[model samples]
Target: MVVNVSNLSPRLRQLGLVAVLFGAIPAGLALMGGGYPFQVGITALIFVTLAVSLNLVTGTAGLLSLGHAGFFGVGAYAAALAATKLHWPFLLTLPLAGIVAAALGVIVALPTMRLISIYFAVATLGVGEMIHVSLLNWVSFTRGPMGIRSIPPIEILGLDLSGVIGGYYVAATVAALAIFAVHRLTHSYYGNALRSLREDDQCSAAMGLNPVRLKIEAFAVSCAIAGMAGAVYAHTASFISPDSFRFEESILILAMIVVGGLGSLPGAVIGAVLLIVLPEVLRGIGDFRMIAVGVFMFLSILFLPKGLLGEASAIGLARRQLGAAWRGDIGAGWK
Candidate 1:
């Protein structure tokens, strides 16, 4: 009972922190009472997935994507269609949705890879609008604004996990996986290549980094992850429409990364959780809740330009963790 937590190895400390955070979710929800609080927790976790995925492209790779929500919608629709029309299981639909969204991302990246700066951003906006409009007007396929209803809940190995607590666990698991994957990717040499592109694509290309190919790969991966998040959203929400993935949604995702710290993974997670939970916490403010949220964001930007957990600090923390592992101080965990 008198153990010194600070003296624990980095790897063990990391694992303990993760376990505590994951365990705390249900406990916190229980204390607050399930119902709406559980819903908020589920939504927060889903956005955590989205925020991490978006960070791969916008934060690490230095691509300003304004149409990320379109890919998210694509995944949601893909999962919805497969579940409803083809009677696919949750297991099947999840990966299928990611694959579908990745394919679309690759298609978009192929033509738009040559563009840079605001041009690329504008192109993505157009792509997002196109996806939204198609979903809205395609009537026959997307149900034309009526939206898809009665989608199956999450089930795996014949076990239904659609209820509130089960749903929260599922979402938390996905969010945790996303964070782990992105954390590994960002703290490695591959992630360094992505950062190079972000800092100076032309310089990176001159150094034989193949900037175009890297950009496409990053975009595709990011899209795939976003799609997976969408799949979870569709299954858990049990309904979805084009309205769920609009340009406004893209802005929110972007804002998460920005407010969290453009190049920081921890920042992305913190920002997502903050943005999602802050609004709910302010609900007691009634009419001015949104204004209060806006004010908080403004104050954060004004005071913390680099974010609450900026990229530099995150990278340092990661390096220390990796160093501890590599030195055999942590017994080879998280290397």
Candidate 2:
């Protein structure tokens, strides 16, 4: 893997290493002092994971899914059912929730594989709403809007992760792994092919790539990752209701992906973190928080067209290009 990464452009390799280091900061903090408020960071980190995984499908594969929260809701309910009805442990329930969500993704992706752009997004929106409605109406399974309470704290071996501090560690570790997996996936051949399809689907198909299969696979993987986040959230919060997985959550996820920048893993992480933190940072404004959030989002888009991280990268590249030109390297200009 080191050799493969080394073969990339020096800038990309450096950027990747720097990103890995930055992503590990949460774990480093968890090893030291942390408190319940850290769970808010953990929730934000889960958003980071969800956004990165969704980037795989939307940013890389040119596939848009508005139904992602459906998968999240599914994972939450599945874990709840497992823990309460089946008497299964939370550990066992979480992964099962992921599996269930992945299976649903596969099912949804199969019929929608032929869709593109707006039609696909609209279809997913409807799908997400449908599931949410079912979750609300299905009192027997989801316990309806009344919700399930007293969700047992997750226990790994004999260690109870009942404390918010412990939950932060678990959440950070899980979020880190999820992001790393996305990073690895995006650098693999599969990622290359997905990007190719994103750039030009006809061209990719002409090159003998099964665009349908790839899109479906990306969709499934993205949903599976989101489901994992949702499952963890269920246990961490120890309570869930239909209102929890509302359509607004879907919008927030989309906003995170977009604000972070398209087709950039680090961008996704940045977006999730800022979007999560921005609201809290605006606490001084009280009733004006939402306005402040919108203004920040607008300025970020206007000033940094590519994204916060992407613009910083562009500056670095420009400096590198200037240095190369001064040194009389291969080219007088950089692309």
Candidate 2 residue 230 C-alpha distance from true site, Å? 0.7
The sequence of per-residue lDDT tens digits that candidate 2 reaches over residues 1-335 is: 25664346656765665565444555555565666446667778778878887788887787777877888888888888788778788778878888998999999889988888899998888888988999999997788889888777788888887887667667776787887677657655677788889889989999999999988888888888888888788888889898878788888787787788777777888899899888876788899998888898888888877775663453344344335432444332322
**Superposed model 2: Cα runs more than 4 Å off:** 1-35, 311-335
TM-score, each model? 0.95, 0.84
* lDDT (C-alpha) at residue 94 in model 2: 73
189-283 in candidate 1: lDDT tens per residue?
Answer: 68888999999999999998999999999999999999999999999999999999999899989888889999899899999999999999988
By lDDT, who's the top model here? 1
User: What TM-score quantifies how close candidate 1 is to the native fold?
Assistant: 0.95
> What is the TM-score of candidate 2?
0.84
